[model samples]
Target: MTRVQANLLLLLAAAIWGGGFVAQSTAMKELSPFWFIGLRFAVATAAVLPFVLLERRKAAVKTSRRHLGLYLAIGLALFGGAATQQVGLQTTSVTNSSFITGLYVVFVPVIAVLFLRRPPHWIIWPGAVMAIAGIYLLSGGHLSALTVGDGLTVICAGFWAIQITLAGTTVKETGRPLALSATQFAITSLLALIVAAIFEPVSLDAIMGAAPEILYVGVFSSGVAFVLQIIGQRYTTPSQAAIFLSSEALFGSSLAALILGETIPPVGYIGCALMFSAMLVVEVVPELSRRRAQAV
Candidate 1:
């Protein structure tokens, strides 16, 4: 796919995730965090089973036992990110979680340079700065007042950055994106299930009560959105993907305003503008550079 198409897919995935935040938060009313995560991913695993089978039949999907550790690592990072975000949402306001989790927009480039030995385009730094400033303003213009929950959400952002980078790199190395996606979902479900069994009380009635929310998040957010992410990242740099995916915070804030009737302050519009500009910077700068080189 073209870079434009890839980024658009990433944007769509972010939008799905943004909307899933509501289901995620609502499910908390009837389910414990780990139980909710476990059930949601279990449903995701089931939803993706058909695709896995189709891919196997069409492309002869294959995975090596040697890559088992990498898949497990990806799944563990996903579980860590999702679990922390859910638990953090219990105490932190949605605004706080949205903004704090967006720190991954910055974390991605940092991690890439430091460990992955990949230097992002020069524009990424300025764009990341703009996006972060937008997040701070979009999140009510202050970060001084933070709870323990906010801290956990920040940690979640780190794991999310790791998961994104790993998924991008490993998919290329493994040559079985669908299989990798399925394996990670399965691993995440199993891990969440084990944690829930130890820490949370899981009952059939509770699961039934939260079934709609669970299914929505499981099917769309975990299954479809994640697959889109793997596909999109194949065509774009992780840094670019990070910028697009971080728009989840923007979408979440907007969706919450619409659905929950929350009010956006006057400054929030400016924040939104800046965030949009940040995304454009990532998209436009590379094209501009390519054009300049061609002209020269």
Candidate 2:
């Protein structure tokens, strides 16, 4: 695919992801967070089962035991991130959750620097500062009274960054993004189920009550959005994909306003602008540098 096509796919993936946040928030109303996660991932795993089987049959993509171990480890990271975010969402507003979760944009570079000894461009630090400010404003400009959910979500962002980095490293080695995704979903489903069994009262009525929301999340968010993400990222650089995916915050906030009657304060608009500016800086500066080099 051309760069333009790749960028477009990334944008489309972001939109799908943005809408998934809305589904998650809606699902929270009738379902316990763990229960919802368990069901969502269960359905997602089921949705991808056909593809997994077909790939195994057609490509003979059998994972060795050693590779399976790595896949499970990646799945654990994914599960940890999702579980923490869901717990945080229980106590936080959807708008806050969206904004806070986006901190991964900043965390990714930092974690890469720390864990992988990857040196980020000089622009990344300044962009991260702007992103932090944007997050501050997005969280209603109240820096003084941050809650447990805020802290949890921030930690969740770090885990998400790690997951993305691990995915980049491992997906290439495995050449099995689809199969890896399936494994991750299955692992997440099982983990969530165990958590729910321990802490949540699972009842037939509860399941029935959450049926619609569960189906939406499972089918659209976990299953479809994830597949799109894998496909879209295949054609784009991680940096480009990150900027395009940041559109999720904008889309999520707008959807919340339209569907849930959630209102963004004036400060939230400022936050949105700052975050967009930061993304532009991160994405555009490098492109301009490359163009300059080409001109020389």
Candidate 3:
């Protein structure tokens, strides 16, 4: 797919994840964070299993040990991010968690530069600022004093950055986005389940109570959205991908209002504008610059 199409897919993933915010919140009302995550990813693994088999039936790319390691590392990062975000949400306000987690848009480029020695295009820097500012505004411009949950959410953003960076690099090399998605989902499920078994109490009744949320998140959020992420990242830089995906906060707030009767402050419109501008800059500036350079 073209870069624009890929980025659009990433945007679609963000919208799905935004809707997941409600399911995640509601599920935890009856289930603990670890159990919720464990079950959610478990269902995701099952949801993706059929497509994985189908993909393998085609011209599948061989995975080397190094490639396998990359997939596993992304899974570890996914587990870390997922675990912390859910646990953190228990204490932090939704506004704080959403704003802080959206900071991954900023962290993505920083991680790329520091670890991979890959600096993003000049456009990404300002786009990051705009996206983040948009999220901050979307959160109603008030970040309460740091709580333990807020701290955990900070760590979650770092893990998200690492996962995005790794996924972008690995999928481009391996050309096996479906395999990467399945591997990461399975590994994340295994890790979350292990932790849940050790620390969280899981009752069948509680699981049943949260079944709808789990199934929705597992099938769409974890399975479909994450697969779109891997596939989309193959065509875009991690920094650019983050710019587009940062719209999750926007979509999340909008969905929360629509689905759960949550109220959004008036400033949300400004935040939405900024976020759209950010995505627009990232999408259009590079092409304009390239054309200008060619003309000169």
List the candidate 1 regions with Cα displacement exceeding 4 Å: 1-14, 58-62, 226-247, 268-284, 287-296
Reference-based TM-score, model 2: 0.88
Q: What does the lDDT come to for candidate 1? A: 0.80
lDDT (CA) per prediction:
0.80, 0.79, 0.81
Residue by residue across 146-261, what tens digits does model 2's lDDT show?
A: 67787788788888888877877776676777788789899999999999999988778878888887887788777777777767777877668767878887777777788878
- Relative to the unseen true structure, what is the C-alpha lDDT of residue 193 in candidate 3, on a scale of 0 to 100? 87
Q: Runs in model 3 with CA error above 4 Å?
A: 1-12, 93-99, 127-147, 226-246, 264-288, 294-296
Order of quality (lDDT):
3, 1, 2
Error of 2 at 20 (Å): 1.7
Q: For model 1, how does the per-residue alpha-carbon lDDT over 148-221 read when each residue is reduced to its tens digit?
A: 78778878989988987888788777666777777887888899889899978878999999999999999999
Q: Write the per-residue lDDT of candidate 3 for residues 82-150, one digit (tens) a residue.
A: 999999988765545655677675577778889999867698889888977776675567655347886
Cα error, candidate 3, residue 48 (Å): 1.0
Can you give the lDDT of residue 117 in candidate 2?
A: 97
Number of clashing residue pairs, candidate 2: 0
- Lowest summed lDDT across 10 adjacent residues in model 2 is found at 54-63
